[model samples]
Target: MSHDILRRHLRDLIDAYNFAQWLKTLKGLIPNEFICKRWTSEPNGFIITPIDQIPGLNT
Candidate 1:
């Protein structure tokens, strides 16, 4: 595979694993949820909102 294709596959695998972990261990809250909650409490710590880190609207 080309570099871009390989990178995409790797990212997909990571996302799938993360989703499973959230379902199995994290109680349906994503790893990003921690960041998002912190972002809510402390906006100065982040340059961008972690809401974008969430999986929604396919973005």
Candidate 2:
């Protein structure tokens, strides 16, 4: 019903849901994909900005 209550219920089933294991499996799929990208917005974090705004990234 509420955010906290929903999160608490999900937390109890973390193992049953295999959340961490599912993430690990997804991580392994990254390399299998043909096209992979790591575009960055600013110095610290990764966010996608318009090409015109981050023209420095243009190659």
Measured by lDDT, the strongest candidate is 1
**How well is each residue in 20-43 modelled by candidate 2, as lDDT tens digits?**
666576674442231122233242
TM-score against truth, every candidate: 0.43, 0.25
Worst 10 residues of 1 by lDDT: 26-35
**1-59, model 1: which lDDT tens digit per residue?**
79999999999999999789777775666568766776888999998777875777954
Each prediction's RMSD over C-alphas, in Å, is: 8.7, 11.2
Point out where model 2 deviates above 4 Å: 15-59
